[model samples]
Target: MAVGELSEKRPTRYEIEDVEAADRRSRWRFRILFAVVWLGLIIGLAVGLALTGRIDPAFILEVGPFILDGTPTTLLICFSSILLACVLATLGALGRLSGNPVLNAIASFYVSLLRGTPLVVQILFWYLALPQFGVVLDALPAGIGALAFNYGAYMTEIFRAGVEAVPRGQQEAARALGMRESEVMRRIVFPQALRIVTPAIGNEFIAMIKDSALVYLLGVREVLWRADVMGTRFFRSTETLLIAAVVYWILTIVLSFFQERLERRMARGDR
Candidate 1:
């Protein structure tokens, strides 16, 4: 190749630097635009509420503390439900992947039924229908049970996907080392699967925290229930509901931050 042609073909250092700088500026512009869009939406919501005369500053001031006090109860139910869900998801995932036909069928049916039905209906059934079958449960327990079963069914797929993502060669190598199937799963497969699934589980946990408000249908006295009571008492349903929505949004953002950190830590571990 001619010397002049070779120089033309390879970009000069200044050209490469200019291209990289332009790319960085474009990315930063997109980031700023994204942030502004979200901020605008939030401000628009507030303006709409005010223009509609649906919110009262005095009511917010008076009732906000009372409603905020229910955060602990909401968190309690969310964490409790997630704990149960994790256990159920693990077992359901194992059953679905098991060699035994009955186990597989049971797991399949459980996931289908729970995932197919509305979570609200499930909550009502646990709260009301079970008594006829002599499995009466208190409101909190029934709500937690409904949440656990519903989330467990959904998360079962996450667990299964995580487990399946683990390399088959690793399992075969474990077997070659004389480890039984169960032992291999316990010591090798599950730990790795856990790392893969943890971020997904965190996302589900955040979703469940929002869904936990549905437990209000069971009179579980969580944040939504408190908001309802405050709205009804003060005749400011819109305000209270909006406040509840804001609280939930804030909580979800905070949880998401922690989830991101958890994901980063797990990624570091993988490295």
Candidate 2:
């Protein structure tokens, strides 16, 4: 073939660019299509339930306020429990990583037992069983203590992983500067670990919010408990429960949005 003919047959630079851009657009379209399908499915399910008479519009209207009224109590328990969990998690993480065998054993035992048992059992133990031992607790305190203990066990691993993820050299450098082990951890290690684990911690917090629903078993008037009360009162248990579900979903979505933003900000700071 002649050189001129060969050159003419080759794809132009603009043609190649156009093909690449088309590929990128197609990929975006595929992603958008997937999202649309999920959104459509969710909408369809809601419409189906409404049409099938499984969900009561009238009851929803009547009970919505009652359910919402309990959101503050739910939030209070969630935040308070997570606060206590954070403290326990910090102590547990430190103990787990410590050289002291006694601390290590104690931390390990706590984590093992808490993680092994069902959360409901722990809640009952705190509220019901503990009273036999002269450790009677009011409903709120019992619920909060159970939540904190359960989540602390789980979060201990997250904290430990975050702390361990820090490079050994950082600790070594701090120690070389005449810092004691405690100072090195406090001044250098824990802060960085916190950044590493903040997203995971946020996720745990969100999960805890939902798990807090179980506090209803203790007769705490959180969202689910209030929903049950309204449901029983009006004989519209299904509708009330659905409303509570929606409220919890909304809360989680809002929290997740902030969690993502915080994660991105932390990532940027790392860079």
Candidate 3:
């Protein structure tokens, strides 16, 4: 009698494994789809530029001088203005935190006024109004002052947040050690606050760099304006603008690398 032998098979892990693998493949496909879409868009834009006669060599060369020089000029304006803004912001934050009501009110009002006004208006105001007081500043200085004023108001919140981030017990600990409020703040609070606020400050730096472009509207000849001038004069507007965009992208990337490193370093200290 040929009895039917029981066919023994191990239970398959195939279904579960297949589902997981399929999910991974689907995720990869989604990512690839997104990347391809963006890539196509960028290529389309580049092609459009070429078709529009924007990539012409004569156009690129026409404003090369302005394009090159405008980079360093923009950097100078941004760096100097940001430095000044940080200084003023620190002081304003201190004033706001101070016990004196008058100082607090003045600091608050300064922040309110600057934050309330449009940055372009501030730039124009500094450029146009200051001359009425017989204190005409060069384009560079006027531009810096306008940027600093606008950013300083914004930075007050950053500084204040930093100061407030320090544990209250830190101040009390300093006081327990017989230190005065000023000394405690200088020695303990500000240092901690700086570290805490460094990332926020880096963000402000990026914003300031972009905002520096507005200085060109005041005829300071920064990168964007230089590109505009070159493009208009030679009708190679696309090439010049592309070059400017590349320059700004490079700068932003470089700065971002440092920011990331600093953040990692700060986080390490936290651990």
Backbone collision tally, model 2: 0
lDDT of 2 by residue, 1-271 (tens): 5754655798466555577799999999999999999999999989988998778787788779988998999999999999999999999999999999999999999999999999999999999999999998999999999999999999999999999999999999999999998899999999999999999999999999899999999999899999999889878888898889998999999999999999999998964
lDDT of 1 at 238: 88
What is the C-alpha local distance difference test score of each model?
Answer: 0.92, 0.93, 0.88
> lDDT score of model 1?
0.92
Sorted by lDDT, highest first, which candidate order results?
A: 2, 1, 3
**What is the Cα-based lDDT of residue 252 in candidate 3?**
87
Please, what is the TM-score per model? 0.88, 0.89, 0.82
Candidate 1, residue 119: lDDT:
96
Pick the lDDT winner.
Answer: 2
Candidate 2 vs candidate 3: which has greater lDDT?
A: 2
Better of 1 and 3 by lDDT: 1
lDDT tens string, model 3, 147-202? 99889999998999999999999999999999998899999999999998999999
